[model samples]
Target: MNTFERSGKHLAIQSWQKLNSKLFSGFTTREGGNSTMAFHSMNMGFHVNDDPDKVRKNRKLFSEDIGFPVENWIGSKQVHAENIVKVSKEDRGSGSLDFDTAIPDTDGLYTSDENILLTSLYADCVPLYFYAPNDNLIGLAHAGWKGTVAKIGPAMINIWQEKESVDVKSILAAIGPSIGHCCYEVDDRVINEVKVALDGDTVDTVYKKNAAGNYQLNLKKLNEILLLRAGVLPENIIVSDQCTSCQNDVFFSHRKDKGKTGRMMSYIGRKGD
Candidate 1:
């Protein structure tokens, strides 16, 4: 996968087929938009306490570049849960509908219909994109600590299977950029939780003890395992080795920003009508 910039505010590692298509999807960066110091520029998350006007403008830039109306994006409130919601064209503008009764607790969203954009917000959390290239069904998920521990990848795959009747093995997965283990220091509590959730196999491969004995967990690697375990082919998985905390210039790192920062978005959708 090779990286490309869209609307100058978003960055993406393009898949082989996506390089020349109207089906636009990618991860956003904190650049090329109107925002203050903490939020910096190009911040797309309104929930991060960035100015509402700036967030709107940034989102508008993204929407225009992608050739979709800004209001058509289906976003989650992102409570770090593993709830996978199956959305359709009819459900368009429902979750983020009216801005008040928006979705409150979901980390994964799936849709087989075209025209409705599926998005997952992230600062450092791993963004997983799913596409059944044959059926053309697509989905996206925000897999943080809680979402990973809850096995959100498998949950999303199961929902897609049931809802769209697509085979799990037919899914192609792309794990977007996130906090690498070199910088994602975790305490014993997170280690224990991840170990238990992964049944010990994920411990040695994804976690390492530093000189100070604190653990560093690689959420990207762990999520790759999750994708494989969920029946996605190993060759079908594309991982962005770029680290958010490592490259603060192109990404928003929650740890690096001390929780006072904006977010980037990983989005995927079929070509609109």
Candidate 2:
């Protein structure tokens, strides 16, 4: 699977784009918007304490360029849990312009409906995108360590299967830019939760214990494994190698910036109504 490439101000998921022309799916890069200070430019997250006006402006730029209006987009509170929401046309404007109106306590969202974009904010945490062309379904997830251990990857698959009767084999998944194992070292507490998510099975391929007595956790690999465990075919899953902390020049990293930073957004939707 090809990793994301630079497209305009954002890094578009070209591999997925090649898979489906009308499927608008990609993650934003921290360029091409009019913001300053820590945000610099292209900051799309409203709850990151950046000026709301600038965030809106940045979103509008992305909307115009991506051909999806901000009005047709829906965002969420992203509580870093495994909670996933099934979106509808009625939920279009939630969290688009303001965080207060965003879907409450949701870390993942999916929809079979057309023309509505589902979005989630991220810095170093993994960004997950799902598409099932047979049913014309698309989904997005924010998988920080908490959400990953909570099995948010499987949570999305479960919802689509239960609510929409989607076949896991038909679900194509993409893991977007995140903090790679090289930069994401965690203490015992986080690894313990990851162990639980892995059903008490520790795979050495997922992480390596550092000399600091912590572990270098591969979040993207963790998500890929979760999707595979949830029944998505191994060939159906793709992952991006871009690391937020390593490529801080192209993205905002919460850890690289010591927690005072901006965020990028991962979005997916149909091209038109």
Candidate 3:
């Protein structure tokens, strides 16, 4: 499946073509914004030391481009944990214009509330998108190595099943652009954690040891494995081949920029009819 289809400055989910047209889901690129310096142009994250006003302006531009209201956007203070929060109308605009008002320590946000956009920031971290069309639920998660080892993908699916009464089998999952295995080399600490998080066979499939003994971990494939284990259909999961670090011109990369980079925003929601 064509996971992400680039249209100008954003990458829309081509796999969602058969779904409701009003279900807006995509990730922003590092183009077409007003931020300066390290943030360059399209930085959508307010916590990355970019000018707040510039970040706000960028948000407005992105929201307008995606056909979603800027006031309807909600975000979180991502802590790289598996903490998924169920959002509602009351949570709208939480972290839209500022970072202080974001949901505390939340890396994933899911909602059945229409017209409320759920967003999370990312640089090299994987952006996991979930949709349960059967229940009109949408979810967005920031899955860095910490969150991935914590199995945040499966955690989101569990939340949907328990809180939203969503059937896991009906969930559609997408793993967005991040630092791919070609550039993501990790030491034993991360490798051990990944080994602990995933099954033995799956670990082999998602990780490989290099000559220096460092391991290359594929976060996207690991997340896909997590989704499959959580009962999502194999055919319903789409993994993007785009690597944020590899394509820094189109996206931001935390590692590639030595931790002083901006962030791209990943959002999913349904507009009001």
Question: Quick one: ranking by lDDT, best first?
Answer: 2, 3, 1
Q: Which lDDT tens digits does candidate 3 get at residues 1-273?
A: 447998778998866844788888889999999999899899998888899999999999888887788889999999999998898999999999899999999999998889999999999999999998888889999999999989999999988898778888899999998999998999999988888887645466699999988998898888898889889999889989999999999999988988998999998988777
lDDT tens digits, residues 125-205, model 2? Answer: 999999988888899989999999888889888988988888888998999999999999999898888899999997998
Candidate 1: list runs displaced more than 4 Å. 1-7, 16-20, 94-101
Model 3, global lDDT:
0.89
In candidate 3, stretches whose alpha carbon ends up further than 4 angstroms from where it belongs are: none
TM-scores for candidates 1 onward, in order: 0.92, 0.97, 0.97
Report how far residue 147 has shifted in candidate 2, in Å. 0.5
| Residue pairs in clash, model 3 | none
Tell me the lDDT of candidate 2. 0.90
Clashing pairs in 2: none
Error of 2 at 109 (Å): 0.7
RMSD (Cα, Å) for all candidates, in order, is: 2.1, 1.1, 1.2
